[model samples]
Target: MLLLQANNVERRFGADILFHNVNMQIDEHSRTALVGRNGAGKTTLLKMIAGITEPDEGTISKAHDLSIGYLAQDQGLDSQNNIWDELDSVFAPLHEMEKSIHQLEEKLSSIDSTTDEYQYIIQQYDHLQTTFKEQGGFEYASKMRGVLTGFGFGEDMYDLPINSLSGGQKTKLALAKILLQEPQLLILDEPTNHLDMNVLNWLEDYLRGYNGSVLVVSHDRYFLDHVVSQVYDLDNQTLTHYTGNYSAFTKEKADWLRAEMKHYDQQQKKIAKLEDFVNKNLVRASTTKRAQARRKQLEKMDRMERPTTDDSSIHFSFHSDKDSGNEVLDVENLKVGYNENVLAGPLSFKERKGQRIGIIGPNGIGKSTLLKTILKKQPAISGSIKLGANLEIGYYDQEQQQLHPDKTVLDEVWDDHPEVPETEIRSLLGSFLFVGDDVFKTVKELSGGQKARLELTKLSFQPINFLILDEPTNHLDIDSREVLETAINEFTGTVLFVSHDRYFLNQVATDILNMSSTGITHYQGNYDDFVNETSTLSQNEDKTTIPSTTQTSSKKSAGQQSYQASKQNQRARRKIQREVDKFEQEMDSLQAKHDQIEQQMSAPEVATDIAKLSDLQKQLDECQQQLDQAEENWTDAAERLEEFDQE
Candidate 1:
């Protein structure tokens, strides 16, 4: 059933129209991920749906008695109480009802055993019990506990002051409280940003099992891929819907853009032809009908505009030497941890020149620590880390460290490369979106992202062979990230980056060093390979053990204990098999989608018009090509898994 509806929704700010004619129906079972560029009014649209803000022109209706749980990007949860108290507060009304019911039961049981008053009270007591059960009172406590635990809050933390919790922890607690509320419509914004992967997975599972409607705004593709069944992309002052998860949405959008481009091409041709005929025949009285008809056709056409495609990682870079024989960094039995908790594995790892490695793990894992250890800001406890020769290292801390707050932006950027003129500095900064007066602003006055961009100017300066970036995308908006991504892609130097930005990882990494509880596992491909490997492994598990097919055999390399090694190996193989099976399933699905798109494009309604037909045909071609590539990758994954099964 539709939980909420928005018809002819038009929202405006000053003279700008954020969107218009956005008719929508949000159903109880549908999960939608809202996506748009920053400042595209996603949050504003959400506010309108929540009734917190009004649309300038529209009618919005909610299903009768429908309750919505709306969580803003940074939830302002007012509290000074304990965590458990804050969590249990969600059940306050139910708790009060339970108390009243219990009191009435006591009164009914205690007096006038055969009286009508007693009997009526007893009957009412039974009614209340039924009502409480219907309201999920029985599961309330356990569900609250489960939610807290799932979101990484320990039972011990239940007693801690909510005020003492970190901002991120507070966000998690707020999320837990909302989850426990279990409203008919759940709305969340960037809910997974501060969550670790394990918690994210738990949340994903929870949302998948949710009975209510779900709508969220998030940049985490993994979360969207797992939780959302549909995508509502807000673009160009319009709302467009696509069926399926993020990956499917990507393909669907690509096909749509291709179709649009084709339409544009065809319409241009038709317009040209009509214009030619009109120009040639309009003066002749004998051909007035043809000319008039052609003019009408031109006037009546609902002109098609070219659709934009994904910015597909920019093409940009530096020249580099491939050979390294000398040891650039050395360590023995290195170990790093904070407050007595271990961060990096005792088992040592090293980096050499000509290597482009990506360190990926859940948020707050040792990815940052490992990077810092290499930088020597954090000491390694017990394992050897030896960096190989001629490595001139340049580091990009996600924290935006290199920038000086007191310095002017121009002074900061030109301080090191002063030999270059001011014009060159301004021009270089302009590429990163710092234009005109922006270059003259003090670093202190700049926004976090602006400061990070200023710091990134160093990427243009250093003649270093090795670049170590810790979440270079942290301070970067999508555009800046794209610029830096392009520059990194073109750089001929060795790079080792620690990142959770999957898109960035997908485009940049040539190799992956995945840090997990079991230690580091090196994979020979980019981030996609890493995700496929891990996700594939996860699917293959047999209830308890996580098999590490490649991770096990490399004991001398991975340093897993001997007694459990073989068991791990067996499990790993099974997991690999499962992953391979999943790939086959996915590849088949992709092929089906390709065929479906082809059919739609081939339909007469879509294809009869030369312009529209050309567009559809072009999309059909891109889909076909994508399908072939997906199939090949699936086959390759299957072969590797087969090796595990053979064992």
Candidate 2:
């Protein structure tokens, strides 16, 4: 069943058309993604669907009483209530029902058992109970708890004032509230922005088990691949649908473009040939009839216009004037922070001239502080850092600290290199997509993404053997991220950068450094490699511990204690494993049933039968509920197992 449809949608900004004749549909239970380069109207299209903005020309059709929850980028909650209260407000209806049930119960106790009032109260109570169960009244609190924990909000922080939370925390809180609302359709714009890897993974699992249709606007390819079943590409003022995930979409789109371009070239050649023949033959009297026939054919034929592709992207490269020594950097027992406080480290590491190291950690663990200390932007709390000879460092600050907001884009670069001519500066800006009049605009007027591009443009011209980038991919679109990855991979200099973009880290990093409040742990390979290695170590630890109960004596030998601890650990693992297996089985059963219902819904007779359709929908809803419960169970079991392993 289709939940929402936009037919012949057209959106315009003043004289400029953002998109025209755009059509899309969201089916019941579908997971769809909207993707495009920055400023391609993807967000605009989403807004139109969400009823936050109206299309200039088109009609949006939705199921009757279709509930929708839309989460836009930077959408924060405004509340005087604490975190738990804010989230609990989503169940106001259920709370009302609970109150009515209680009131009836009180009235029933005062009336005689045989009285009509008592019987009436009993019926009301029964009805309320049925409604409450159907509405998930009993499970609402538990579900809210799960969402809170998944987003890294623990019980200790549940009482914190909503207004007191950080921007990222507020965003997470907003998302958690939306999840609890359980609308029929969920529209999320850049939902992955503030999430760490752990939260991101949890969200993927959560959304997969969601009962509603989801249409999301995002640049996170990894998240899209994991959650969305279909992709919608918005490019050149049009939208095209792909059947699979991001990776599959890429391959399919490439093949389609190749075929489309080839057919267009062939058509153009044929037209040219016909025109030439007609021109050569028209002058001769004997061939005049043939020429006229050719002309008539040309006039009658429908012309095919050449297809255009989007190519508005930054194009630039990084370079070094001189090579650094083999050992580019050495840090021993380094601690970085402000004042006397240490945010992270008591750490040590070495970076070679050609190594690309990626630093990653939870929010506010001092990844950026570490970078500032290395570049001498801030004082190190303790220890030492040594830079190799002939080394020049270029830094890309996530905050764009070096940019002069009052300076024009042209002057921002030119001021740094006065010897470079104005024309050359304009050309460089053009490569970064700041063309013509754009260069005359002040840096303060630029968007976050535009500012990032300007920063990269400046970084590109600098002569440096070592690069230190702090969350460089933060404001970039997917295409820009890929371009940056390519540039980093091709550059001969060493790179040490902090990013939450796992895909970027997987592509460019030769090594990974995991940072925390305690210290830093170095890994030999990329993000995936680090995860695998850590998992293996955790598994080994879990397997090696013995149960304490196995020790017979009150005072046991050291070897006996170790064996007993191992046995206890093994028993705990078995318990978690059993729970995991059970939930997995339940999930499989629900999926199979869901698929069967879909097949049944598509049948000719079932499609026409309203009663049958309604029945199937009810079945689907039940299946979704079971699937959701199964997923929650599995997540709890897995997290517990991980905690045990860590211990």
Candidate 3:
């Protein structure tokens, strides 16, 4: 069954057309990933689908009984209730049932216990009690606790007033609310922006097994690949659907465009030949009828419009400096936490020179808290941090919640470092992809992603050898992410950053720091290495020994059937890919053989040698046959690849 449908949707912001003539249908159990450039109407289209905004033209239809929950990137928790109360509100239905059951028991007590009315009411009360139990109302508190923790809200924050939480915290709470609701269709915009890798991986598993459908608007490539089966790219004022994860979509989209270009070329040639016939013979008395027929054929041609091409990507590289002294940072008996409680450790961890580490754990597992303790803003209750000499720290806070709302982009940069000249400051911001009018927008108006970029922009201008970044890629567009990532990769200093962006982590981080209740655990490699080791642990629990540098993980187990199903899916996909690779090799061989035949035919000696020419012609025929077979095989392989990607 179709879950939702939108037809000929058009949206314009002022004079700029974000998108037009967009049509799409979301089906039952569909998992769609919406992607486009910064201003390419991905958000607007989602808004239209949710019926929050009216489109300039056309209508959107929703399936009967289909419930959608949209978690926007920027939202407010205006309630006065605490975080626990706020999240528990999603279970209002269960709450209502319990309330009614209590009321029925009270009514029975008001009447005579022996009366038929009282007896009937007692039976009704018993039924409501059973219903409440079945609805999990009896265990709702534990579920609430688990979800809130999963989203990163601390036990202290659980009772904190929602009105007092930070913007990012509110977003986290809102996400928690949405996830708890578990609606029929989920639409999450940049849901992973503030979440760390641990939460992200948990989400991947949750969404993978979700009974309902989901449509996500996210810049996190690794997360998208793990969850989404389809990609709906909103670009060039039209909706183009690619069936597959991000990687498969990339390969298949290219192949599709190439094939379209070939067909376009053929049509152009036919049109040109018809036009020539008409021009030359239209005025000739003998060939007037032939010219008219050719003209009619030309008029009937279906011209293909030019396709949109993605632009060149941006890149940035940092000037390399000598590596810092052996000990970049060392903490002794670090007991980090909020208010009063210890997080996971009287834990001690050290960042040696050239250790590119990724701090990962669930949302509230003190990933950011660890970085803050290092910065000295988040005071360690009892432990001490020792920093090496000449260690200059560049901190990227997720709250970006720094960058005074009153400060302009230029002012934010200039105010921080008065010694830096305007031209130099502007040059630095430009490197972070802030250009022209963008520099004038108040820090208050910047999106989370934008503010993140702006904050990083400020840090890049300063002389910092040691960098402490908290969700550095939160608001960056794809191009800006590449730039920031490149700068980090080339930087000679030690980086202790907290990021959930798997793609970024893969490219930049050298080691893995898994921070949990027990403190920090150091894996010998990057994110992939951590996943592999953990995967091994899952496979062999008894022999699994994690690093002493890291915290112990939760006692989590993957269901055997679920685990096997995932492995089987991967195996099947690989079988398909192997076939594609085989066909591609054969196709390449056929092309080489065809090229050899063409070379021989082009030779002057072969043209003169009639006897040799006949032999060559026979070989050429055989080669053509092989080429045709190869082409068919390639076509089949491509079709299968697309089919597999889309599903």
Candidate 4:
């Protein structure tokens, strides 16, 4: 059954068409994602589907009596009620029914046993009781509590008034209320914007098991990959559907572009050949009839227009003047926060050259604070930081605090690199997608994404060997994020950055530093490796020792005992090396099989096969688990190898 459908949707702004011919559907139990670049009218389409706005040239239809819950980005609850009361209000009808039942019970006690009024009241009471039970009135509180707790709100916060809560808390409460309402269709816009990892995990599981249809607009690639099975891409004034997660969509989109380009190229060549024959032979007397025939045929041909591609995205690179020393940075017992409160750490860590370290922690746990203290923008609560020789720092502030609000985009870049010519500076700005009149816009007039691009442009001009970024991916869209990831991956400098984007971390981070008020725990390898190791620790009573740095052997004299220890150490190192190789091979083979299974699942013939889909889903899940374990084993072995080499 179709829950919602938008047909021939056309939206316009003044003379500009935002999007047209946008057709979409959400069937019962469908899990869909709407993805597009920033400014691609995704939010507008979502609003139209939720019935918050009307389309200019199309109709949106929803099933009769269907309920929809829309959670817009930055939408929060405005209420004087406490958290629990606010969430409980979703079951207001149930509460009202319960109240009437009690009233009916009281009236029954007063009425005579033989009266028709008593009989009617008794029937009404029974009806209401049945409705209440059907609506799950008895389980509402427990459901509410489950949602609240999953969103990181505990029992203590339940009594807090909604008006007193922070903006983020209010937003969470709004989502919690929607989940508790259990609408037939759930539409969410940028729902993962302010969520932490724990909340993200919870929401992923919740949505995976959700009974109703879900359509979400989010830039969180990792979240989309996990939750959405189908994706609707809104680009170039149209909508296109892909059958799979974000990664699969990327691969399919690329293949589609290549195929389209090839077809266009072939058609263009044929048209050129026809034109050349007509041009050279039309004037010749001997070939005049043949040329005329060719001309007529060409005129009748339906020429294929070139396939337009949207490429209005930033393109730039990072460069370093020179390499830094072996130990790029060393933080010892570092405590960072304001007002004598240590929000994060008594942390100790060593960052070597060419190591991309990603810092992750919940909001207000001071991930950004750690960056500021290390960059000397703020005073550390305690401890020392050592910067190695020739370490020129480049910092990208997620808040864009380094940019002057009054300065024009052109002046911002030119001011930093005054030695460069004006034309050259403008060229640099254009490379960052600030062309024409856009360069004259004041920094304050630019959007968050624009400011991020400008900041990146400035960073590109600076010759730096070390980068310390704070939430670098905060305002970047998916495309810009991927570009940034590629640039950073190719960068030779050491990086110590804080980010919540798990996808970005997985792409660029070579190590993970989980920060907290208690201390910093360092794990070798990327975000997935960190998760695998940490989760394994929580599951087992005896926590496995995560691989880290090892000290050099102090026994220099060659006694029998020393000799035996050396031999054992060598054997262990070789074993670890072999294990690393084995897991690498296994990971490669599993990934290939994973891709094959996904392809088979998306095949037209197999797509509707329920039993086959279920079996393939089972296989995919198991393959994912095996791949994660293999990666973990590889990380552990690699770390052990490095440790042995260092010793």
Candidate 5:
């Protein structure tokens, strides 16, 4: 069923048109993404679709009684209630229904059975019970708890007042509350902004299993790729729908641009040929008729407009003036934190020349603090940080503190190098999309993205052999982030940066440093590689414990002892192999059953019937649990067999 549709939607600001003729649709359970560069009116469009604002022209039509939950960028919940109470407020109607049911039950027990009032009261009680169950009245508390846990809020934090929480925590709570509400459609803008990787993974899983349609606008490509099935590209003052994820949309957009350019070129050539023929032969009596016919054809032909590509991205690259030694950085037992407190470490890691190391961990694990400690901006709690000889460092701070708020964009770069000419400084700023009057804008007046570009401009002006960036992609859009990735990849210098953008890490990092409260584990690959390796290790750790066998030295020959041990090992291996095979069969059967239940739940007849859908959903959930257990058993048996083989 179509949940919403925007027909010929046009948004304008006074005389300026932000976007026009935008058309899109959202069906039930649709997973859609809205993507564009910053200042492309994505948020404005979302507001119009969410009924928070009216479009200047055209119409947004939503289904009758359709409910939408909109979470704006950085929007947080403001309440005097505690965290638990705030989320609990979403189930007010269900609570009222429960009260009504209890009152009806009491009246039914006291009244006579043969009377009309008793029958009416019993019917009312039965209706309320059914509605309550169907609306998840019995599961509301558990559901709320599950969502809170997924968002990284534990039971201990439930009693905390909303006013006592941080801004990011409040935003997360807002999302958690909206999810519990379970509106027919969910509209999110920059929902992943304050989320760490763990919370991000949890949210992705939740959104995938969400029972309603989703429309999200986010800069996290990895999240978009996993959560959204369709992408609407809002670019060049128009919205174009692509029937795939972000990765697929990129490929399809490139192909579309090439095709558009080809068609435009072909049409232009035809028009030029007709104009030349008319110019040459329109005056001649014999070919005048043919020239007139060609002119008419040209007039009647449909013209193709030139395809426009938005290339106004920050264009700059990092270049090292000199090479650094083999060992760019060495940290031994480095405890990074403030004052006498320690957030992470005893952490020890080394950075070789030309290696791009990505640091990732949960929130407050001291990723940025580690970078500052290495740069000597903050004193470490203990341990040592050694930099190789002749290494010039360039650092990008996530907070943009390196930029002077009172200074203009041009002066920010120009003041760094007074020897460089003003024209040269202006040209450099232009490359970062700071052109003409934009250079005169104060740093404080600049947006986060603009400030980020200014900082990069400064970094590019320096001759640094080692670059340490702390959340460099924090405020950057998709295009700017891609540019930064390319610059890092092409740089001859070493890079050690912290980021939550998994896509950026996958593109640029040659190694990943997984930090934790205890220590940091270094993995020799990108983010995806680190995840794959860590997941394998985690599975191994979760395997069932195997009993150890003791081998006794016998009073026999060495050859006889070796033959006997080999036979014993072979028998053990066969036993483990049989166990592995049995577990595999069980897993296969459970997976088949799981898929079958899912198919039944998706059938139209069952989907519209709430009771049937609920039953199938329970069956599917139970089957999934069994499948998970069977897979764990298989992993354990397989590990045992592999250990035997190794022995």
Candidate 6:
């Protein structure tokens, strides 16, 4: 059933049309994502759909008795009640029914046997009981607890007043309440703003299993890829629907653009030929009738407008005047925190030249503190940090504190490099999307994204060989994040950055350093590889405990024996390497089969054949399972080889 529909929707600001002729539909159990770059009026369109505001021209129709829950970006709860009470209020009607049922029970006790009043009360009681059971009265508290726990709140936090929560925590609570309410439609804007990886994973699972329809606007590509089945590309003042997840939409959108451009170019060539004939031959007496006929054809033709995509994105890359030494940075037993308190570590890691190392951990686990400690912005609680020769460090602070709010955008860059000519500086600012009058705007007036771009602009001017960033993709939209990822990947420097963006990590990270309160585990691949290795380790935990570095060192000291022992260890290492290679080949085969099945499923003829599609889907699932097992085996064997090498 269709839950809601928008037809010919238009929103305007003064004489400017933000978006027009927008049409969308939400069906029962639909999962939809609305995606666009920053300043594309996505929030405004969402408000109109949620009935928080009216569109200037259009009609929005909804199913009768439809309930909508809208959670704006960074929107928090404002209530005096405690966390539990605020959620419990969702069952107010059930509570009232319970009260009336109890009252009916007491009245029944006082009434005479077989009285009409007693009989009516008994019927009302039974009806209320049935309604209460159907409405989930008995499970409400457990459901509330489950949601709160999923949002990282514990039983101890239930009594905490809502106003006392942090902004991020309050936003989480607001979302938790909405989920518990279980509305017919859920509209979320940037709901993943403050979520960590674990919470993000939990939320993705919840939304996938959500009973109601969902319309979400989020910049988290990884989350969207997992949660949304359909994508609405809102760009260039129009909305276009694509029938797949975000990754598929990217491919389809590219193919669509190429096709459109090809057709447009072909039409333009034909029109040029027709125009040339009309212009040259219309004046000639011999070919006048033919030229007139061609003119008529041209007049009847429906000209295609020039196909355009949004190209107004920041363009800049990092450059180093000289290369750094082989070892860029080395830390031994580093402890990072404030006021001599250690939040994370006893950590040790080495960053080699040209390696992009992404640090990931839960919220408040000292990832940012580690960066600051390395840069000497704050003192480390213990341990030493060593910087190699010829290393010039550039830091990107997520807080944007490096920017002088009092200075204009032009001055912000110019003040750093006064020797550069004014025009050249303005050109640089323009490249960062700060044009003519925009350059004159004070840094304080710039939005979060603008500040990030400004910081990058400054970083680009520096001839640095080492870049340390903290949450670099914090305020960047999906497009901007991709651009930044490209810049980082193309940089000829070593990067030690902290980020929660798994997609960005997968794109740019050569290695991942998983931080924890106990210690750090270094994985020699991107985010997905880290997940696979960690999962393998977890699965093998019951078989044998993985030794820490110190334990390995102790074992090395104790196990030094004869030459035969060393030779046997070498043989074992070779065996593990063979196992790793075998798993790698198996994984490659399975992955290829998975891709082939997906391609078959996407074929038009197969898509229309239900049985064929279902069979192909099952085959794909089986291939994926095999691929997953192969990856785990590969990780396990590779880890064993790494341990042997370490010894």
lDDT of 5 by residue, 220-244 (tens): 9989977899999899888999998
**Root-mean-square deviation (CA) per prediction:** 14.0, 21.8, 10.8, 17.3, 22.2, 16.9
TM-score of each: 0.75, 0.82, 0.66, 0.81, 0.82, 0.82
> Clash pairs of candidate 5?
none
Predict model 5's lDDT versus the native.
0.90
User: Which ranges of candidate 3 are over 4 A from the true structure?
Assistant: 82-146, 152-161, 164-169, 254-313, 321-355, 361-433, 440-446, 455-468, 490-494, 516-519, 535-647
Off by over 4 Å in 5: 108-120, 282-287, 543-647
The worst-scoring run of ten residues by lDDT in candidate 6 lies at: 555-564
RMSD (CA, Å), candidate 4 to true, equals: 17.3
User: Candidate 4 residues 1-647, lDDT tens each?
Assistant: 99988899999999999999999989999899999899999999999998889999989998999999999996889999999899888899989988998999999999997999989999999998998999997889889889999999989998999999889888988888888888999999989877888899889889988989999999898888778889999989999999988876876787788788899899888889989999999999999999999999889988777776554678877888787899888899998999898787789999999999999887789888888888899999999998899989999988789999999999988887788999999988888888899999999999998999999999999988899888888778898998998789778888889988988887788999988778998999877778768755754643343433111112211222443353356456656877888899999999999999999999988889999999999999999999999999889889988887656
Candidate 2: tens digits of C-alpha lDDT, residues 503-533: 7887788899999888898998777677668
**Alpha-carbon deviation at 215 in model 2, angstroms:** 0.9
TM-score of 5: 0.82
Per-residue CA lDDT of candidate 3, range 47-138, in tens? Answer: 87877889998889898878989878766567899988888888899989988988997798799999999989988988989888987888
Name the lDDT value of residue 531 in candidate 6.
Answer: 70
Write model 6 residue lDDT over 408-482, tens digit each, in one string: 999999988999999999998888888879999999999999999999999998998999999999988888898
TM-score (C-alpha, index-matched) for candidate 1: 0.75
Task: Identify the superior model by lDDT, candidate 3 or candidate 6.
Answer: 6
Scored by CA lDDT, what does every candidate get? Answer: 0.76, 0.87, 0.79, 0.87, 0.90, 0.89
